[model samples]
Structure formats: structure tokens, C-alpha cells
Target: MGYNGPLNNAKYLKACFTKPYKFFIHSVVHTVSHRKGGCDVMKDYQICMVTALVLNKKYNFSIIVFHYMKENITSKSRILVYLRFV
Candidate 1:
């Protein structure tokens, strides 16, 4: 038999990876919701936004580089907004 990798739960692994993306989306929604109060919450909100971008750049190897142009694989975080509507 050919070398097959360890037998593991694929669904669970997918859930683990997608969780961060979902959380990122959720935080943005919460920020918009709370933005209407006209309070100083946006400063802290901006910090959270920066932190998410840093995490995506730091941890996601998939988005590190493009296949042909050699440009960084920019994350489509805005796609999360579409997801929220769906």
C-alpha cells in the first residue's frame, strides 16, 4: 500500500481553521453595530482590526505568496461580509 498519512477527522480540522476567519468576521460586525453610539469605542475597535490583520499575515501560509506574480496572497477578508449576509 502507498504511504497514507495518519487517519484523522477532516471535518474537525476544517472547523478549527475556519473558526479564526469566522471570529474575524464577527468582530467586524460587532464593531459596526456599536459604532452608532458615537462613543470612543472605535479606538479599541481599530486595535482589534489591526490585530486580526497581523494574525492573518503571520499565520496563514496559504496567503503568503502568489503562485505566478510572486505577490503576496492578499486575504479576502471582505468576503466575510458576503458570508454574513448569506
Candidate 2:
């Protein structure tokens, strides 16, 4: 399965922060997408996690977002439902 769609804006944002690290964004998405039992929301969440790590590394934003995600998204079903609106 090839990803022909335009790169997500998050990829650009990651590039802006650290050019060297941008390459992982698409690879991570691609790798996760190819893995069995993963869904669209999980892929999206992985993107979000990558972005968050980039932002946290550059801007040092409070890690509350990570904690919040971990606490709220306790199950695969919950992640699927929550990320649908995110």
C-alpha cells in the first residue's frame, strides 16, 4: 500500500523544528500502517505522538499532553472513538 496523498501539515511542522528528524514522520506512519491489527486512528495517534515529541524537544512544552492522552485513552476502542473527532 503506497501513500500517494499529500504529506500532512504535521510533517511540515516537524521539519520546521528539526530538519534531520522529519524523515521519521512518514516512515513511522508507513510502518504502523503496514502492521497487522492497527487502525486509522492508531496511525493518526502515532503521528500525534511524533509531533508531540518534536514539540516537546524543541519548545519544552509541559508534558501534560502526554499524561492526558495516556489517562484518557485507556483502550483501543476509546482511542478510536476519541481520535475520530480530534
lDDT (Cα atoms) of all candidates against the true structure? 0.33, 0.44
Query: In candidate 2, how many Å is residue 52 off?
Result: 0.6
Pairs of colliding residues, candidate 2: none
lDDT, candidate 1, 1-86, per-residue tens: 12123324221111222344445444544443322343222333333443567565443323311221232123443222211221
Poorly placed runs, candidate 1 (over 4 Å): 1-17, 34-86
Stretches of candidate 2 exceeding 4 Å from the true structure: 1-19, 22-42, 57-86
**Most TM-score-accurate candidate:** 2
